[model samples]
Target: MDWNCKNYHTLDFELKKYFGEKAIKLSINGGFTCPNRDGSINTCGCIFCSEKGSGDFAGNVDNSINNQINEQIKFLSNKWKSNTYIAYFQSFTNTYDSVINLEKKYTQALNCPNIKGLAIATRPDCINENIAKLLSSYNDRTYLWVELGLQTIHKNSSDFIRRGYDLDVFNNAISMLKKYNIRVVVHLILGLPNESNHDILESVQYVCTKGIWGIKLHLLHVLKNTDLANYYYENNMKLYTQEEYINLVCDCIEIMPQDVVIHRLTGDGKRSELIAPEWSLHKLKVLSAIDIELRKRNSYQGLKFNQEQK
Candidate 1:
């Protein structure tokens, strides 16, 4: 059962190392929106984003953090019976709001029962000194992780995707977060329209050199009601199939630093919102297929990679 590579760190095992037990990330919609999509930058968002701003499957915002935690606890406990949970503020730029608002939402989740820590996903440009200071303070009491969406290092690709930020923002955020000892997780989307496979792999290598603690891989997805959908309809977009994606994912993993946690290897497509590359709707099947192929090949993360070899 060595999937893709022997040196790779699976996300489950990585969590156990920090939590001392099984830990679940309770995905919460903290009622946040990205500045890029909020008319500040005058962009609709990344072309692949859905109308709900990628939080469509996130927990209902009508409930308070405590209520959301309590509800999820019941469902997860009865189903998986896990005792530890991490309040994951997923969807949109979680740190884009003011410090007071950030404190209110995060404190509510932190006070919830069974929650052992917090994880906030946001854009690199949205991170501020106040956000970093507030988040770093929690390290003394609980695990704190900030997940940044650094989709690519290439400026041309970033501009084409309208990510609304630059690589310098990511570098600065990572540096400041590390100075305070807060764990950093980077989200790198593979298969942007014009990037070659080598371009994607180069980004992974760059992130590793930046001292990231974890990484998540997502195959480029074209969802309904997105600018990407327009491109698809116009025959201007290219997407990766399950087989193509799995191979590239394995290759990326093989080149990743041995200790960087692999948070995800596939994207969970929102069925109602997805438009093209329909195979993504079957995420489990794709992941399992990746695992099977990796084992058969006796390959592992970092197996074919060496920085000097690059």
Candidate 2:
């Protein structure tokens, strides 16, 4: 059987089609903060967030953006050997700062010799007309993707996770980004506490109706020293087993539209920080299982998609 997925679009294929070559993302921490953590909203931050603000796999925050990108390029050169790179601002609310500072950091990345584009991860509430305009100006110069963290659309799940914004906020952000022709990538988490399987699928369907570019599907990870960890210890929270997760992800992929690139299928938690769902450490195994299960079902992405849903 052909191992390449025929039913769905992968990030690698999309990148190759656009850049005409293999381009790897170099994670960069822009030393940004979030309203949820800075007293602008709340102080506890997301219940599942780590001390590093979801930049555990990203480069050192203390280093300058340019330095971080350079260091990662040097390290990844030995592994991927691809000259093309995307400067991914992965930590915290990348757009929380003023427009002037945002331009400075983003411009610095664009000026890098090897960088081909920029991917900024931020919250929906943090965006506005001024910021959207500033980001749109780069559309002609280089590729730009605005990543929004929307763990789940369920109101209860959103509240449990301490996500400060509402679904309307996310919809408005998407509308603003689309107005500027900037690509949007949404982040969704499966197996959130108290959310049913139906809830997760509904979230996926909702995203498909919106005019977005890509989606990153992640498994809820319980990390050490976080409120989630404490809750797990106190309430005996249960996470999905490996087999259960594979089945759910395959189902999610089937319903996803073929044009929406699947940016990621699973979570990548640092071993040192991970507290539950130990099987997530074996990332390759999880990916292979998804592939195998899809083959078994003779299903590909969009197998269950309905145009009317959009």
Candidate 3:
């Protein structure tokens, strides 16, 4: 795939490759909350978690699932001609509920007209055999993938972030999802606290080995009203510059297996809530710089990939 004449296999290209048209994702808030915030793990969510439970752009939780889908479709149809859409349950801990409730919440979205698939996002510890089985059954019916928040593979980093889970839990979750042949997408945050470049890439290498169908490489966004925001000022945290972040993303893209779809290369939050790396506010410029930088280096996805390396 030419991937929009870029250096990596983007989700947009992947969708076009399969559907022959654009597949816009409709972010849905299922009124779900994370265990990490529900006192199951702790009251506080991840250090960078937002008051919206990381669903800053998701549909309103006040509306019914069907209403949210319909509203998004109506809003997006005017802008995009394509009818295809993937209902992304992007809020905190989409699968934290019982298997019965998971089925109901998922079916509500999947039943919506023009909704082509489901992208359920959640933490690793929340998954089990029942959830995998349920998602696998859905996989047989539509295009689907589960996104797990494994921000970093390093335990120290994970611990520092109060991620509330271990690498072993993530490893087990992936194994379970793979056993059911469910498409899996893992989220990795670049420029985490105290992590060197090597630490970041090593985390990338580790997750790619899990047979991930897609990957979301999120640039760490420091948001207001989170522990990270306070820590940023208290500890004087330094974030990645535009140039440095683009370079790191290119490195991860090159090392990623060619088949793994790049779901996201950057992240966005409400500008008013964002505290640093003001350059990241220019999402379009940041994205274009990535393509230009890759072209400048004459590199492409999987160019530096060594799957055999430890």
Candidate 4:
């Protein structure tokens, strides 16, 4: 029920703990495209990406930035009354488009009547000094957070996942944002096809050393119409069960650096297109199961880890 574990703090629990009120992220798709999918970096996009580019489960394209923020606020506020929100640009590479267009969309969201902040999800290679400055512009008025997808730090595993960029890209992005005092929330997917437990733990350790503000740990889900789906269909891949995934997650958290914010402990799957990982269909159950086991063993995040991780 409580959100804090020893090493990590869930986003919802952390926000409530700090602000003393309920908070939510309003998922926004700002009509942005990715260089990888557009043939700038790679042609097929990341291996795990859905045909709709992963934010299809979120809001619609016709929903303007302001409209999405307002609709989410109306829905959340009616129930929580005093809750606040972060406009999360989640769909594609949010920062890949021209800075002017990003500015216009972000400005509309930030200036919306009820939004409290913004959370942008983009690839590591997409961030730059100018983008950092633009993000810093709203820091004084809003709680700005950037989420970079670093699925795994091991180069071979990254290549296997077809993450499109390397560890150097992630390092530069974090450093640039840190220079402007912009908070970063990194995303890493667990249970990747070929990664071992050692690989998973190593990735967690590497990300911890980068000094990010938060982390979103996800299990790789095989959605329909993607290369990963074909892998599953051809007997080349597997999904974790509820128990297997919980153990992996608990282990990752126990080794994660203590100060990181855990934005999510699991992923939300698009039920219609999902192939394996049927356990993800009941995300809340998975979380509750993980929490119970963590408590049972009296273990918490960073329980056996150190900040001086290499």
* lDDT for each residue of candidate 1 in 1-310, tens digit (9 for 90 to 100): 3423433678788777767778988889899989889988856888777877677667888888788888888887877757789999987889989999998999899998888889999988888788889888787788788899888999988998898888988899998888888889998889888899999998999988888889989888888788888888897667887888988898898888677788988876788887768898898798888877777778777776676743
**Model 4 C-alpha lDDT per residue in residues 32-105, reported as the tens digit of each score:** 88887999989898888987677865577787877777777777776776657778899989999777988998
- Against the true structure, candidate 2 reaches a TM-score of 0.98
Candidates ranked, most accurate by TM-score first: 3, 2, 4, 1
Ranking of predictions according to lDDT: 3, 2, 1, 4
* Per-model TM values vs. the true structure: 0.94, 0.98, 0.98, 0.94
lDDT of 1: 0.84
Error of 2 at 286 (Å): 0.6
Better of 1 and 3 by lDDT: 3
User: Could you give candidate 2's per-residue lDDT for residues 1-310 as a string of tens digits?
Assistant: 1214544688888998888889999999898999999999999999999998987889998898889989999999899878799999998999999999999999999999889999999999999999999999987789889899998999999999999999999999999999999999999999998988889999999998997899999999899888989989898888999999999999899898778988999988999999889999999999988988988999988889897877
RMSD of each: 2.2, 1.5, 1.1, 2.0
Query: CA shift at 50, candidate 4, in angstroms?
Result: 1.1
Evaluated at residue 132, the lDDT of candidate 1 is 86
Worst 10 residues of 4 by lDDT: 1-10
Clash pairs (backbone) in predicted model 3: none
Q: Over 4 Å off in model 1, which ranges? A: 1-7, 307-310
Query: Any idea what lDDT model 3 has?
Result: 0.92
Candidate 4 has what TM-score?
0.94
